[model samples]
Target: MAGPGGRMMMGQSGERSMDFKGSGRRLLRQLLPEKAALWVMVAAGVGSVALSVAGPWILGKATDLVFAGVVGREMPDGLSREEAVEGLRERGDGGLADMLSAVDFTPGRGIDFTTVGGVLLVALAVFAAAGLLMLVSTRASTRVINRTMYRMREEVQAKLARLPLSYFDQARRGEVLSRATNDIDNISQTMQQSMGQLINSLLTIVGVLAMMFWISPLLALVALVTVPLSVAVAARVGKLSQPQFVRQWQSTGRLNAHIEEMYSGHTLVKVFGRQGQAAQEFAEQNEALYEAGFRAQFGSGVMQPLMYFVSNLNYVLVAVVGGLRVASGTLTIGEVQAFIQYSRQFSMPLTQVASMANLVQSGVASAERIFDLLDAEEQAPDPVRGARPGQARGAVALERVSFRYDPLKPLIEDLSLAVEPGQKVAIVGPTGAGKTTLVNLLMRFYEVTGGRITLDGVDAAAMSRDDLRAGIGMVLQDTWLFGGTIAENIAYGASREVTREEIEAAARAAHADRFVRTLPDGYDTVVDDEGAAVSAGEKQLITIARAFLSDPAILVLDEATSSVDTRTEVLIQKAMARLAHGRTSFVIAHRLSTIRDADVILVMENGALVEQGTHEELLPAGGAYARLYAAQFAQAVAEVD
Candidate 1:
């Protein structure tokens, strides 16, 4: 079953199996580019097939010539050892001695003066042509496969960038990484091998069958007796092994996810003393992967031996019938020889097909997974009408807005609020009181389920998502830093040309300049993942600097100082005041001291605002705001003492 956000659910029964034929064709179409070079490669494959069949026939004809001279009374038109010997005997009479002296000769096998040179010439040409065609086909197919893989990788990466954040929240990072890297590599390998071998094998089988029938229909019929049985066995094995292969890949992804989690949280695990439990859990996942892999591989491995046994049985029957016909003198020994060669050729391709069955099956499984992701619906389209810079007034209004992450439980219920230009409004609440949800709606990360939000009389849904986001600046509680210089991080969202002096000024306003200047490279120093090089307070300041650089008409501060010490909080509050100047600001905070100066304080509980007033007004009213203020103030005082 697929869960919300298109995540697959695992169970004892496993997910529904995919149709290999349909999935394979669809994947191949997507991967192959629409270009003339691709068509040329296919044409080369066809030519190679034709040349391969010709090579085998030429070899078979040479074998027939030898068999004719040895067993049949009639000599082959081409020269034989006996005929060459006779020619040498005639040449020894001294009339042709001069001609013989001009050529180098080997003593073991005398050559016929008339026909040996021509036969050797034809044979050499046949082998050379076949080898040349094979080489061309191999090269062309490899180029096509590599180009196809390059396109697939590019598309997958592009899709990942465009996918909504909610998709990442539900899907495992390790699994997505596995699909893009390991699974796509497998698909490319399969395409290369299958393209080369499948075409060659099919041509070999067809060519061998045609020759066998031409030589003797009875022998051809005898050799084909194993075809149906081989196909039936292979089909059964493929069906049984397909599900195991899928399960093996699924388990591999889970194992990768577990290992990534454990490695990333090593410090937390040590603090909690969970080393032994983590090791045991890892061992269990390893065992599960091993079991699934073994079952899938074991089933595929038995196919070759089973196919060989059936082929040998058919070979014996062909030999007996061919020998009986030769004894009755109705068939020449050369024809019997040709028939035997053709029979082996027919069986050989079936053997190859059997061996490659598992490769094909695994490729199909990978294709199915890849296609599932490609077919997922993308985020809803943004409005086509472009946004122009409006008047600097930052009035924001929400009219009966309602939202729910899950339909069964509403996070914000019919809430409406308005903030005039240059107003500093604070939303105070406990955990899960719809504070962050309100910010998310205002940023349009998630759409409102019902009602409308307008900015300066423009409906948010009617504006381009990019334009909407660009006009608002947010400082989140969790600050994310990319691997870049401090100057780059501070100016991340600045669209206009911003000078180094301007970046430094923003950092100073956010109270981050003193610490940044002391670093080894100052503004040029690179930050590690999530700014691990800096303390949490420093990271918060850098985020505030980024917001300041954007110079947005509206500012949102969501628990911006929640994780910092008291002194750092005081510094950030000063920076916040500077940033909030002349902008419509919305602050969501749990600490009472942070929001005490808000021009309007809205108290929310259970998804709705239960009270609205200034700090002084709310305290005397003794409503939800007063109760929250009292509780948080007591905690702050105890910490201070």
Candidate 2:
């Protein structure tokens, strides 16, 4: 049966043994959060089992009393004909009285209707009481386990928030999702079904064994032999099945990951005509899952029948020996009957324990995986309290900045630059030249390895992350809009409630108001997930409007106008010119013409600044910036021709 802590007793060796204790301890600790309710449930379960166990023994006693009454003999336990008749009369049971009066009071001849009827009624009442207690216990357990799981789910969500972006970069989205959903669900089911089954089984075994020994120690001793044999069988099978359960869950995660990738990239797969290839990969994963699952289930499946076989042998032995004892005049038939029933009862829990072994093993494996996630190293803790500056003039400087995704290979080194307030600085470079890394450092998305970046002469790290980000606004090329009304999308970057007028003004500032008003709902038009209903250019405009609504003192525009047509680009350029008039703006672009009027054009190559000057000055210098401008200009001419 399910053991304490809701684990099956796998009398095994190696990791299985340790898993039994370790996983059991952790699961118990999780339950302790709802311990008060759990304890009450346990009490009810105990009472229910106690009442149920009393049934067989009471029936056995009543059997002996009735036999003696029919024989017109007094019971050895002090029950007599006079007492039975008197008790029947006291209860005013006329039907029983009439039946008893018809019987001749001859030894071992007729039934004692009153005593037998009364005893059967008592047994029914006892059984009904037990059933009620069981119902209450199960209901309480449901509430307790569900609430505990709810708290665990909340903690997992909060834990995900505290983890670093780097963690997500290294982890698979589907695998993480599987842990949160499937793995946790396994634990929930195990607690609900296996826990109560285990508790009831254990109580039944204990009560039945006690009764067995009280009646005849010889019969109990024979039944005890099967216990060790059953244990050995369980241990051997459990050890074999444990690793398969691990493999089963691991394969399940891989299958989920593959499905997620296929679903997310279904269009790409179809365009490439890779449906056959995709099916092949899925079949491989599915086969692996099937193999592991079959092994795990088949291994544990053997234990129940094996234990039952041993139990059947024990039952036959008890019956044969007990009959012999009755024939020798040392045991009553009623006592032998009770002992045989107890022998059967003793084996049932063992059978239950064997049957639940697979569930318990799978649960432990899932729990271990979940705990691994919970114990993963989180991001370095942010300061509990830090500087929250009121205002910023937007002067930014980087000194001796160096960074690398990996320590062995550096991506950026000694990247130093400075920008005064209200200056438009454009950073231009080819792909993989670290143009975006600078913005990442400025935003503290990734920490610099070597040097400090400053905002208005103060080390940016000295300020809280919230305070640092509050003073700057960013508009990225990959626009993101949630499922909401257009007005909500525009007001997303705002810190407080935004009125309709303000949202419209922000849209106008981004040159998006005209198109927005043309929609059926105007600013209230609903945007689907990923803004799929809108064109790429319109999505970019929505993001620009969101940035406009924030109105930070500093702005970072990374290819903000790349998706729009020439007309929309020109409008956006004019709008951005107004937005950046007095703010320190950092512009990153590939089209050199977009930043021709920037106060300073910084050209980067291979993670270091190679050229920095006004647009006119850099063109005359014939340096890296001049070459980039000429290449782009020639490409544009070639395209037009």
Candidate 3:
């Protein structure tokens, strides 16, 4: 159900079944780094559950002491425990006499408060020690959970860095971000809330079961009869609810995508008067999320009450069977009481685990998503010792290059060009032409499927991506400015530290200094990620200034002047002309008027070079370049009218 590029379409979760047990094992394996701490947690949990389980058995001894004292006081004076049992048997009360035979008491003595008090004190100490051990277990579990989460987050970040640019180009922004943030957070919370408790619950079940069988094997069997029923119920509900949780998370991602797209382009939505349409789409996604979330929660929610009911049935069976054993003298009153407590202890853990099914299911579902991202294909590793351009003279050439985004559809094929240092080349084409793709190939954002590109006769592919990109400066049409001052934004392009003078000089070269000084804070003015403090043209100018600051051997301006007014565009062109004076420059532009003075122009159409010459020469030939010029000129005339 996954569409192209690993983006899951609607209903994918239903079609693709989740491997609950496999994912559970993998999730636990993520904790291997904290193995020592987990062992400590296990040790503490065992000690805690052991002492806690001892509480009831020890208290049962106290009960027996008190019962014996009370029974002794009821007997006639001067009669020992044996005398009372013999008297009962002679009175034809053989069952009662047999029960009395198990009790130890002196005929004249009342309740032995001293002995009862001693047992009660021991019980209190055992409980206190158990509490302390549980606290230690909880603390250790906290360390393991937090450290594991921290490592997982770092791994996810590193995985993203190693992924190819093409993966990001095809994947939805929401799916990626949701995995990084929402899902990881969910896993963290689930572990924090459930890890210690789950460990204790499983240990408690084992300890309690052991004690139950130790007291009475017959009663232990009765208590365990309902366990399989509980398991069946939990497994069935979990199977039904697991897929819903996956769908719920997927819906969350889709809804996030819609909201982000709408918010980022709110102006466009308003300009086109499609606010209602956007709202409608938002409602649909929200409703789908709500439906998925409700179903997941509701299905898992049924487990707790169902489990509780089954446990109650087990309790009833144990009590009835235990009472009969007591009446038949098979078990004393105190022993029967202890066996009943053990039955509850055993059932309680099963119920607790069943009740936590939702959290476990949700957490594992999120882990699966994170693992998928981590296991995604990464770009090829860089060579151990990649080549670098020799002093970056910037002599660039493409020899018999072929490339495509999709293997089935070629975008650029058998394209070749050469540019000497200090020459500017202009690429002109309509939308979907290979103009930008050509620049991408040269930048090595995408590897060429065939042939080679070389920088100063050194193959680009042989060079490390970082080393290859270091000597190139690019100013994209869609500018990006992080949250910082204008000075910092411009300095981002510099490979090394720059002084205030150098920063100002770069801004001046891009014709952005005069307008910047007009602002309240000048170069220190704070701008957000949206660059809202600056106008559209100002943002573009800042990006161009950033490129100028780099002072690279090669400059790429991809529609860099598209956002500016005519006067600003003319000034930028002049500044770029000066910058291109001694560098290899590739300029991609749609406004043909901007590149008229270029040393050479290449016309591209349908992934192929149809014409190549100087502007004057190509216009005379009346090829693809000439036809594009005529159409643009006509549009300009129509706009003027």
**Number of the top-ranking candidate, with lDDT as the measure:** 3
Off by more than 4 A, model 1: 1-13, 66-117, 322-341, 386-389, 496-502, 565-567
Deviation of model 3 at 551, angstroms: 2.7
Per-residue lDDT over 1-641 for candidate 2, one digit per residue giving the tens place of the 0 to 100 score? 22223332211112333356687689768888787788878898889988887788778767766655644653223544455555566789654544343333434335667777898899899999999999988988988889988988998898988775656766667788888999899989988878888888998998888888888888889879778888899999999998998888877877887898898789889999999999999999899889999999999899888988988989989999987776554666667777888888888888998889989988888887777678766666667776654568999999999998777788989988899999999999888889998898898877888989989887887877778888899888778899999999999989889899999999988889999989988988998876866787788788888888888989998876766788877877777677777999999987898888899888888888899999989999999988898999899899999
Better of 1 and 2 by lDDT: 2
Q: What is the TM-score of each candidate against the true structure?
A: 0.86, 0.86, 0.96
For candidate 1, what is the TM-score? 0.86
Q: Write the per-residue lDDT of candidate 3 for residues 1-641, one digit (tens) a residue.
A: 34346655332334577778898999999999999999999999999999999999999999888888888888998877888889999999998988888777788788889889999999999999999999999999999999999999999999998887777776777768888999999999999988899999999999999999899999999998999999999999999999999888888878887888898999999999999999999999999999999999999999999999999999999999998888887888889888888888898989999989999999998898888788777787788899986688889998999998887898888988888887789999989888988998898877899999999999998999888898999977888999999999999999999999999999998889998999999999999999999987788788888888788899898776666788877776777676677888999978888888788798999988888888889888988999999999999999999
Q: What is the lDDT of every predicted structure here? A: 0.78, 0.81, 0.88
Candidate 2 lDDT at 66 equals: 64
Displacement of the residue 61 alpha carbon in candidate 1, Å: 2.7
Worst ten in a row by lDDT for model 3:
3-12
lDDT score at residue 503, model 2, on the 0-100 scale: 94
Ranking by lDDT: 3, 2, 1
Backbone clash tally (model 3): 0
Point out where model 3 deviates above 4 Å.
Answer: 1-14
